[model samples]
Target chain A: MTKKIPVLFSVGWNACINCGACVAICPQEAGFISPFDTIAVDRPCDIACMLCEAICPVTTITHELAPLKTN
Target chain B: MARYRPYFTLYLGSMDKQYDLVIVGSGPAGATVGRFAAQAGLKVLIIDKRQELGAPIQCSGAVSRHALEEVGITPNAEFIQEPIYGFGIYNQIGDCTTIDYRQLKGDEYGPEKGKKPLGYVVDRRRFDRYLMTMAERAGAIVWLKTEGLGYAATGNGHCDVQMRRFNEFLTIRTRILVGADGLQSQVGKWAGLRTHIKITELASCLQYVVDQVETEGLLEIITGHEWAPGGYAWVFPKGHGYAEIGLGVIPTMTQQNAQWHLKKFMEQSFFQKRFKNARILEIQGGGVPLASPLRVQFADNLILVGDAARHVNPITGGGIHTALSGGYIAASFLIDFLQEDRDASAKNMEGYQEQWLAALGNKMWKLHGIKTKIFHNQNIVERDQQLYATMSDYFSPHSEYKKI
Candidate 1:
């Protein structure tokens, strides 16, 4: 059986100011800043563009988007 | 584009079932328009997600006096942080070029003329709350700690809005819907308006309030890719010897994030000398959409204002002026549409877009052109002196103030 790879992403809520930068810049609408001043990035679109990771001001959006990074 | 509502939501109503105008986000744009619509004898409802108004501020707070007057706000001592007399602009090569507004404007702006200032930086928290009060005093019903989820157009220039108040869900209907929400305009998205803050047109920003560093009345602005790639760093005075030191960067232009860029910016000898013994007072970070002005900002029953419409200045990342002006413009058309034939159709709402473009759209496009030609290009990164020469021509004291 082939081993399954998982979609990789994490949010460092401790560093998140809850400014909603990621939410505003995500073209895929994949991210949202929680009401408790925390952030969650769970959805991965067909392209997995990773624009959220790039546009995050604090670099809090970490995602292992494949092919683009899996050299 | 239409969104279908659940059957359960159709029967949910704990408050007033409807309003003439329903506005989301009680920021400058939302509150201003809400005030006008209410003042014009329309039943208006305004809501905000923030428990407190303008908490964790996300602006440099600088606005021209003419801008405030245009919005009918007489500058009061209550929220005015400091009066900026000029700019302490620095080139990438460490050369400083300062212009005193008094000297630039001459007799028209000097003490002999009147108590005029180049601009004033106000406390955003207090200022936004002041607008909320203004909206409420004008007969607009405001609900705090309420968040707008989405809206569904119900034909004939009306919409059914979904929102949450604490644990209780709220669904309110309105003949005219206003999405004055800031940068993350989910209202526009839910209403099916193209309001995305694209990555190419995004500027990731970070700012800090620090004390113990004495700054003058002038706003210190530093330009160079070494500090903030495709963006700039600033020191906006916040009184009590404190200043908001911040920088923005085009994420696509650099591998590093805004935090990394700010860290590197502060570590430089120029900033190091200023913040040697400074204590951090507050830290905030956000994004500014430096995109070209939207050609269309309304659809059917819904109209977008402020950052939701990408109204921020493309080159400076400033929006208070246009944001305030946009509220007035929206209210102008809205008062007629809602009270006249009660028509909030896409055809009628297009009038709002036309008026807004006539006021500030061309100037914003010009700034976008300059932004694209220089900062976004990245080819002119090393030409510090050349950049200053061209910038002075456009931004100098003698330059056109209307475009600024």
Candidate 2:
């Protein structure tokens, strides 16, 4: 039997503007980043609330739509 | 026998005789109320919780010269930092445009004519103390280091205000109270008024005083997420070697700490290359309420003014002038209430609501709509930069000029 892990939507690295809207609106505190040091502050988005997707003005966020299977 | 047994009497305690009117917080609102009421011969007591009158100030200290002129306050050598002949804008793509305030159309927010400039960016401590001094000169009793604890309302009508001064509890009884406290005002809540400001409707702000800027007198304003998202960064020349370098963002888009965001911007590609040797002086942070027309700002015997009433402009986030205007209006309504013999209840305070709405309510509402429309764009960051560059010429002049 395979265990299922929650999959999260991720933003395109090149399109990410570092606006931080995703981090501000996320209820689960999953979206975290360091604005001062870009590229070093990416984190996993465990909560599937999609708050970031709704707030992304340019719609750069991509929904995974499927949970990853865990060993 | 007279049909009445001598009614047993109950004493509600002796009235505290400190002042007829007590104003909490010595910001622009308190100062205006104190100045006007004191000049009207009403005994006014002004109290501030801070050890000093205006230490740890929380404002950019920007104001229009016209606003001070209306209040009969003049800006001389001590207050005026720069005349600011024009405004500057920079886009995400690094395009720069300049706007001359003197050549602009529509109702503007500064002095009309003079070599001295349209607005002043004074030292906040000095400006606040100056206003407090003016109120004192008008016969208002100044009580520094005094903190307003709570409002004590009697079943009859008057209120006993509990204040702590130098570890001693003092009571002041007044027929009227003016709450000039800032955004986090306790008076608004204590008076049963709504203090709800949605996060999306707030501007998260952070500023730093930096020295040794390359730009001489030119104020630089940068837009786009490259610096601040849903907001802008400004480098206002403060004469000598100092400049107010800050950034702001609509609360909805601002995550992480404000200071961290500011530091990140300072280290950005543009700023780092230009401002390398500048020394950091002071760091400050605060929020500006941007909720169009606030739901409520008045209640029984209490009128919220300044940031307390959400008087800040929605688009510009410039509030010093509005706060000054609010102070004056709050004073006017208070004067009327002082002269009237009627009970100073919520019904009577309605006059203030009407007067404020007449003056600044509609402008704030229109600006709110403009802000909502501007923020909803999928590509606002790029669009804003374009808008700023396009309108730079129109924003330059002082008088009404067409946006070309």
TM-score of each: 0.89, 0.75
How many backbone clashes does every candidate have? Answer: 0, 15
Candidate 2 structure quality by residue, lDDT tens digits, B1-404: 64542233113222236566788889877888799889989888888877665455456666666778787787766656655545677776567776645454314533454244556677777778888989999988877767777786664557788888756687888877777766666677677676655567655667778787655445677777656777777788765668888877664575554555677777874777667777888765455555675567777656788877778777667767777887888788878777876677888878887898778776677667766676777686556754464335334553222210
Which ten residues in a row are the worst by lDDT in model 2 chain B? B5-14
Model 2: how far is B277 from its true place, Å? 1.7
CAPRI class of candidate 2: incorrect
Which stretches in model 2 have alpha-carbon errors above 4 Å? A1-71, B1-18, B101-114, B216-218, B381-404
Residue B127, candidate 1: Cα error in Å is 0.9
Candidate 1: tens digits of C-alpha lDDT, residues B199-226: 8788899998888777777777788778
Least well predicted 10-residue stretch by lDDT in candidate 1 chain B: B6-15
